[model samples]
Target: MKYNMLLIIFPLVMVGCSFSTSTESLTDEIITPDIEKIEDVGSEMITHHHMYDNMDRGNHDYVDKTLVIDPNESEIFRGDVVFFINEDGEKDLSRVVALPNETIKISNSQIFINDKKLDTFYGKAHRVGLDKDSYFKMMDKEGNDYDKEVMKKVFDYNLKEKKLAENEYYVISDDWLRGNMKVLNRETVIGKVIGYTK
Candidate 1:
């Protein structure tokens, strides 16, 4: 009787182990492919020119960089680097500064939203105009010293308060000195930058 009982228990234990291993293998196979499919469908890798370089000045000279874009992003928030089609039928990227139906203005080299100072690290650092020496150099380079008054306007550049439409957003390049500001409709925005590849 003892020998018979041992034989039965050994086979039962072996079968249990085999069943557990098979189950784990099946689960891994199902989960791994699903995760891969999600990644492939949810994000895309694209080469983008780093034209809006407000966060860093060194990358302003039109360097082509790889960016991971999430095209399904539905909610766009302030400070998000977004990809959109410009008025000229070109793909472009900019940082969102004002949301829908909000008033935005650049006054005295500062950004104000709804009569309040924009409270972001980049908001305070928005470069507006060149310094006196740099401005003079630019004037000389262009061979137009007579436009000194016109060039001095860069030092205290200001934009009148403009209210956005219900589906419009105020976007600007990271380098404010470039003076690239546009009101983008919601439909024009394609995606937001999720990450970068070196």
Candidate 2:
């Protein structure tokens, strides 16, 4: 009777172990891809080839870097690098400098948001002051003689205060000297650049 009981109990335990192993493997198989799919949604990898410099050094060279974009973001914050459609109906990228309904002004190569000076690193970093050589070169290119007053005006040019609409954003490239500031509507924004491949 004891041998018969041992045989029944041992088989039952073995069966339980085998069933658990199979269930674990099945669960892994079913859940792993779902997690991967969830992670992949709204994320895309693209090779950026534009000369936009809002997210990089101010060099206006051709780019072939791969950037990871996340289109799932619903809220856009200042200083976020975003991909969007420009007013010219072209895809472009820029950094958000001012949000909706805010007043933005570029005064003497400085940024003012809501009448307050934007005390940020990018705001300070991208302001390229004109050296004498660069100023002379610019004047030469324009077929004009170099003048200190003209050079100062180049650096001191200001954008008049503009208040954005509720669905508008003021975006600028990192190379503030050469980048154009554009007011984009919310519908034109495609996504936020989340990462890049070095």
Candidate 3:
């Protein structure tokens, strides 16, 4: 029993240690080619990985094709899903919500950064209309009313509008209640998603 226990715990400890020591390695003025190399970001730190079933990073069970983050890459832009360490000292991955010094607001789950409405597809300016097919496809998978449940909403609060510090970034995973968009200091960011494995 003791031996079996050691076998189970050893890998977890190794993974954790490796994650803690991992550093981002990319030169400044990086040029990302199509289909860069990637590795499994690991699943243990994720909460509700199921929410991203259709996306690449959503598959926490194994490596889904994902981009490698390069802290030295320079020019962090809106909509990049960054792999970063969180305040708790655990490694995590979330979508970049806002760049440094940008003021942002959240209304009914729609994010407005610098007074421009931002959409989930890498913080692009949201289109004027909804994509009916997108919602319907989500419904087809989860059953009736699942689409309504997936709608993003954040409670209105006095501090709804916020600006990121110079070394901070905003990231979101599924945009639900608890795991909605958040700001991660520049120190936490490892690299932007560059590409996934084939």
List candidate 1 segments past 4 Å from native: 1-56, 59-62, 124-152
- TM-score for every candidate vs. truth? 0.60, 0.60, 0.52
Candidate 3 local lDDT, 1-198, one digit each (tens): 999999999999999988864243212232221234445544322222222322222223113433344555566766555666667876666666677898877654556777666534433211112233454565567675543433421222223888888887777653233343567888767666555544
lDDT of 1: 0.63
Prediction 2 TM-score vs. true: 0.60
* Candidate 3 positional error at 194, Å: 0.7
**How close to the true structure is residue 162 of candidate 1, measured as C-alpha lDDT?**
96
The clash numbers for all candidates, in the given order, read 1, 1, 12
Candidate 1 per-residue lDDT over residues 175-194, each given as its tens digit: 55554577989998888876
Which order, best to worst by TM-score? 1, 2, 3
Cα error, residue 22 of model 3, in Å, equals: 43
Give candidate 3's total backbone clashes.
12
- The residue-by-residue lDDT of candidate 2 on 98-183, one tens digit each, is 89999887877667787677766445324233343665676678897545574466457688999999999988766555565789
